[model samples]
Target chain A: MISTFIRHELKAFWRSKNTGKSIAVRIVMIFLILYLFGCILLAGIGMDKILEIAFPNDDLVKSFCGIVLIYFLFDLFMRLQLQELPTLRVQPYLHLPIKRNTLVGYLAITAVFSMFNLWPFLLFLPFIFKIIAPDSGIIVALAFVVAIIGISVFNNYLALYLKRKSNLNGWIFLITAAVLILIVIADFWWHFYSLHNISYAFFGRLLTMPILAIIPALLGIVMYYFNFLYLKQNLYLETLTARKVKIYKSNTDIPFLSRFGTIGDLAANEIKLVFRNKRSRSSLIIGLFFMFYGLIFYTNKSLGQGWYLFAGMYMTGAFVVNYGQFMFGWQASHFDGILVSKINFSDFVKAKYLLFTTVSAISFVLTIPYVYFGWHVLLVHFVMCVWNIGVTTTIVLFFANRNFKRIDLSKSGTMNWEGVGASQLLLTLPLILTPYIIYTPFAVFKHPDIGLALLAVTGFIAILTRNYWIKQLEADYYSKRYRIAEGFRNK
Target chain B: MIEIKNLKKIYGNVTVVDIPHLSIAKGESVGLVGNNGAGKTTLFRMILDLILPESGEITSNGEIVAGHEHWKAYTASYLDEGFLIEYLTPEEYLYFIGGLHQQSRAQVDETLTALGDFFNGEILNRGKYIRDLSKGNQCKVGVASCLLQNPQLLMLDEPFANIDPSTQFRLKNMLKDANKSKGVTTIVSSHDLNHITDVCDRILLMEKGVIIKDIATSSSTLSELEDYFGVGQTVGATPVVKIDEEENH
Candidate 1:
């Protein structure tokens, strides 16, 4: 049954749309994994020597043991953000004469194939072979390997269970991320206590009493059972249907945008889409998070001024690049109605322009506190704000007409690449590189002010003729309406 | 109300919608009947300008449907769930549609009140997004929203496909009343022969993207279609092809 399920999964993946692109991405990902493995292998082989040189007074094993907790914590954080739920068509099996336990076991076992389970062994196995084997003999080294595998498995199931729980209630996800952030801040910034001491207390003793390695292995078993029971209880199709939260019907419109007539109503719909859907709503949250991006480069007095230029552009145009790249994709779900509705193409384009500019303007204002970095930073941000409103907005919308993939708005937003196409990838080139092309030559010649002025002038001219750009976009969209509608209806 | 000239939509090698010329006049109650893959949807999509034809044109109200804004004013269509914005509640969705046609909130509320029986008290004020509604309720919402605009040219792909029998009867009566009172140029497609014949003044029978029969509705019209479909007769393709050839004259 498991083999048949796996075969079905392979068939579904191969027959999916854009199968060629998915295969290409997989090949690239394979090379990346191998490269990371090489780095970890080298790090493990040379850890004993490096530890002695860096900490001459401390024991090498103690020093190594101190960082294991930190490594797993970071691993857990990355898994929370990057790991995808292993998808199995559990629906068909639910009706057949199959035990629920077998299905849940298949899901849990397939999840172990993830890279998170391999990372620890890649980094630690060589160390145990070269150092622990000779120093404490092979049995203790073997015990440590067993413990490492056990803890790695523990983190895998635990992360999967937490993520599954979080999907049911978003607040659980938010609180988990917050708690993780607080731990990092407390350990690194406040220095109120030390995770190193706690880690060493448990691991350093393993060298003396290798029999104690059984604890981590036992913990991994407990975690697997926990995940199994949780999943078995919640895997019903009915439980997955509706959000458990009670909803209040509040039929309201954006009071300010409603004044623009139909255009306002269109923009209002777009606004509600951005706030209501998971994929779009996160784009807004992430854009706001990046408003603090300047703090990274600005506070580093040793970094080059070029870094600030990059930061300034990103902070001001975060909303534009994040939300604008998806363009008409937000409406791909109901594009048929959009095509048939009594709406003018020009008004539709204008409403998009209004949405982009409004978000950019709000982001720009939120980023103003970064002026404490320098007046120079403020000028760069202000210039990019204009550039975003003018050139970036036009470019984003132009490429938007070319994006035809439909996005499922109900899915989780973290790593789902639904509506992405070649256009979104190519769009980043001009969005980031165009400013550098114009700015680099002037800065190289030591006339940096001229570069800023030229960029601002170009943006100012583009903003001045927003209507002309809107008309051009309207014409482009008119020709692609049928194709876009057809693409969205592919399901 | 709608015109098609040499319209053709080909998928790879299949001519999905190959109509030489078809015209729907104002205030005509036209019903399109066909089995699946008979190009009913493709033709409706072309008329709505949601799908472009490779070799012809659809002109709604004398304006080219491809790149113009004039035709949408008098025409409103609901082909499938694609016509709905599922994130909003039914009431909110209705209000949004009404606002597009420049209908005020009070006017929309009045319309919803009139269709309360059609809704059967499960739609409005239910605090449910259209996505969460049952399939039949979603259909009711889709059809009712189209009515909110009172468009002269209204189209629904299958209004009675999943609806209950009683609601289907109410909808048939409501559509007949709408056509008589407002002179709405309504076009609907359905597989249900009894309801379509009861509601439509004329029926167009399609087979393999071709209109094989065009007949004015009469007491015998339903039985003829049933025979062509081989529903209550000896099942074979012979009688259907004979009727097609006989109707060509």
Candidate 2:
């Protein structure tokens, strides 16, 4: 029965509707996976040398053991962002005559085949075989390898369980991310404790007392059994899936927006859309994370200060770029209704412009504390704000029409590459390059102030011609409305 | 109120919708009965100006519908789930549609109060988005949205398919009352001949992208449509042979 279940999974991968149609995308993904595998292999082979460079005085094996817990902690964090649960694969088998245990066991075991489970072996196995085995007995070496695998499995299942719980209740995800952030802050900024010594003390014993490896193995088994029971009980179709959100009552009225009449109504709808969907809402949350990104660059002050422009642009315009790039797609679920509704196309486009301008302005106000770095940083940010509102916003909205991939609103955005398309990947070129084109000439002449002036001037032009750009975009959209509608309908 | 002249929409070589010429009167309740893929939806899409036709035009009230905004003022259509926003609550969606038709929120609330029985208390203020609602409840929302707009021309596709039996009866009576009082020209396509026959005054039976039977509904319209549909075959329903049997009647 397990074999049949695995076979069904294999067939599902091969016959997925989206694959085999985009050969170029398939080739690109394969190369990306291969590149990741190559990096892991090189890291595995060079582990001892890396340890020697980082900690020259300590024993290589000791240093490695010291970092095992740290490695597992980082692994859990990465898995939280990258891993996906194959929870729905069991839906097809639920009605069959097979025992429920068989299906649950199949999902738990098959989940271990993830690249997260394998990348560690490619990273640490070489050091274990070369350094640990020759010095200690082979049994001790085997115990070390067993301990590493055990911890990897434990992290894998634990992350999956937390993520599963988070899917059921969104607050769980927020709380888990908050706790992880707090831990990092406490350990790094407070310097009140050291995770390094704690890990060394725990794993350092496994080398001398091979029997101590049983602890990690026991942890792995406990986590696996916990996941098994959870999956067994919740494998029912309705339970594994998310239901309607009924937790908090939110006001449906936006008094300020309602005053704008139809465009205001559309903007209010767009706001509700961003807050309601898992994928789009995650983008909103992630955009907030970038508001703090300037600290990484502003404090350094050594990267030639050109980076401040890029960072400032991102800090103020990330949401505009991220959300506006998928502008029409956010409404792809109901493009048919929009096409037939009484609302004018230009009014819809005007609503989008208003949304982008409003978000960019709000993000700028929220980042005012960044001016403490230098008034220069604030000046660059102000210019970029105008540029984003005037130029980048239009560029992303134009690309939105070319994107045909319909995003399923219920699915989370992290590691789920559902709505990504070639248009989005290509959109960044104009956004990044145009400002440089306007900026580089004056900077070459030792008067970089001239470059900022030119960019601002061009942005001023764009801002002044907002109505014209909107009309042009509206005309372009009118020509392709049917095709866009068809693309969305097929999905 | 609606006219389709020399309309032709072909998918590759297959003629999906090929109506030579047809006109629906201003107050006519027309039922479009056909097998699956017999161009019922394709025709409705053209009438709504959602899809472009290849060789002809659809004019809503003498104005060419394609690329025109004037027709939408009085035309409200709910062809499928595609017509719904799906992310808003039922009340929110109704107000949005009402806003499009320039109806005040208070007026919309009054209209929704009238539809409270048809909604069956599962839609409005249910704290669920339309996408999360059950198929039956979603249908109630979609149909109720059409009624709230006070549109002169309203279109609904398969209004009886997913609705509960009790709601279906309520819907039939509501549609009948709305048409009788407002004289709204409605275009509805349905597979259930009984419900549509009870509601629509004129029935157009299409087969292989052609209107094979156009008859005013009477006592025997359901039996005639059933004979055309045959038993146990919905998609493969062939109505060409029923023309001769109909002529004999």
Candidate 3:
């Protein structure tokens, strides 16, 4: 039965509509995994030498034992971010004669095959064989290997359980994150307790008493049973596969947006789209993270002044570049309704412009405190903000028409390349280089202020002539609406 | 009033919708009945200007729908789940559609009150987004939003397929009211012969991308459609006993 299930999964992957894209993504992921495992292999082989250099006073084996807990803790955090839940199409088999335990067991067992489970071995096996074998003979080394396997299994199941619980009730994720953060602060800053001592207290004994390793193996079995029982009880379609109704307070309206009438309504609907969907919300969060781009360039004085423009452009325009790259694709789900509704194409284009302008303006405001780096940084951000609103916004919207791939907004944005196309890759080049094209000539002749003025003035001009750009975009959209709608409907 | 002129949509050599000339007059309630792949949806899409026709064009009130936006002001359609903004709650989606037509919140609330019977208390004020709603409830939300527009021309494709029997009865009354009193031109495609015959004044029977029959609805319309679909033969024919006997053995 398990073999049959695996064959079905393989066929599903190969027969899926986006198999080519998924294969490309898999190839890239294989290379990345190879690189990461190679680094871990090297680290494991030289663990003794590295630990000896770092801690000259302590014994190398003891130091390695102390950091095992730390490594697993960090591993848990990474797994929470990166590990995907193993999902099978259990709906088709639910009414069959097969028992429910078999399906749940299949899911739980296949989940253990994740890279998170393997990384522990690549990081610990060589060290275990080289250091523990000669010191305590073969039995203790084998015990250490068993302990590593037990701990890896425990962490793997624990992460999957937490992730599933968090999907049903999101507060689990928040509470877990808060607890992890508190732990880090307590250990690193407050000196409340030492994870190192606790780790060694357990693992240090395993050096002499090989039988002590059975504790983690037992704990791993307990965690596995916990997962199995949880899955067995919640195996119904409603609890397992169906999206639960989120109990959100019904307050999506923006009172101020009502004043703009139809255009405002369109923009307000888009704002709701961003906040209410997983993919768009994560992209917004990522854009907010890029506001810290100036910190890297400004603190490093060796990088020179030219890099500041690039940083400022990215800082203020990240949301525009990130969100606007898939402008129409975001609305692809409802493009049919949008086309047949009372919305004008020009107003549709303007609503997008309105959204980009508002977000870019807010981003610029957030970066104002960076002026402490020097007034020049603020000047650069201001010019870039203008350029982003006037020029970058239009460029992003123009490329949006070329992106025909539909994006499923319910999916997570991290590592999801659903709507990515060649246009997205090419979009950044013009967004970064357009201002440079106008400014480089003046800066080359030792008149940097003239370059800044030119960029700002060009942006101001574009802002003044936005209606012309709107007309151009409307024409472009009319010519491509059929193809765009056709692509969206295929999904 | 909608007119199709030599409209043709082909997918890889299989013509999905091919019409030489067809026109729906103002204030006409038309029913389109076809099996799957008979081009009912493809025709509706072309009329909405979502799909471009290969040979000709669709005109709404003398304006070519392909490049014109005028028809959208009075035309409201709900073809499938794609027409719905699934993230929004039912109330939010209705209000958003209302706001598009410049309907005030109070006016929209009034309309919602009028639709209370059709909604059957399952749609409005539900805390769930449309995506989380069951397919039947989603159908109610889609149809109710279309009615909220008070449109001069309304189009719905397979609206009866996923709704409850009670709501289907209520929907038939609503369609009658829209056509009889308000004179709203409605185009609905359905697989339910009884419901389509009850709701529409004119029925167009299509097969393999061509309309095989167009007739005014009357007493014999239901049986005629049943005969065309071969469902009427089962009424007079002898029951097949071999399968039941074999199963018993």
For the second chain, the TM-scores of the candidates in order are 0.92, 0.91, 0.95
For model 2, the stretches where C-alpha displacement exceeds 4 angstroms are: A1-4, A14-20, A34-58, A77-82, A163-195, A242-251, A300-302, B231-249
Query: Tens-digit lDDT track for model 1 on B107-196?
Result: 999999999999999899887888888889999998998888888988999889989998999999988988988999889999999999
List the global CA lDDT of all models: 0.83, 0.84, 0.87
- Candidate 1 interface CA RMSD, Å: 1.4
- Once fitted onto the true fold, the runs of candidate 1 whose alpha carbons sit more than 4 angstroms away are A18-57, A73-82, A163-194, A233-235, A239-252, A302-304, B231-249
Clashing pairs in 2: none
Candidates sorted by DockQ, descending order? 3, 1, 2
lDDT of 2 by residue, A1-491 (tens): 77777677778776763443466666766787899899989988999999999999999988988777778788888998878777777776789888888888888898898889988899888988999889887888889888988899899899889888887777877898888877767777997677777788877877789998888899999999999999988887665654522663333977878888899899989899999888899999888999988989888858655677788889889999878777687788898988888899888988888888889999999889988987888888888889999999889878877877677787878655556667766887788788888887877788788888777788789989999998888888878888888878876
Ranking by TM-score: 3, 2, 1
Instruction: Judge candidate 1 at residue A93 and give its lDDT.
Output: 77
Best by lDDT: 3
> Isolated chain A: TM-score per model?
0.87, 0.88, 0.90
Query: Model 3: which residue pairs collide?
Result: none
lDDT of 1 at A77: 89
lDDT (tens digit, per residue) of candidate 2 on B33-66: 9999899999999888888999999898899999
Considering lDDT, which of the candidate structures 2 and 3 is the better prediction for this target?
3
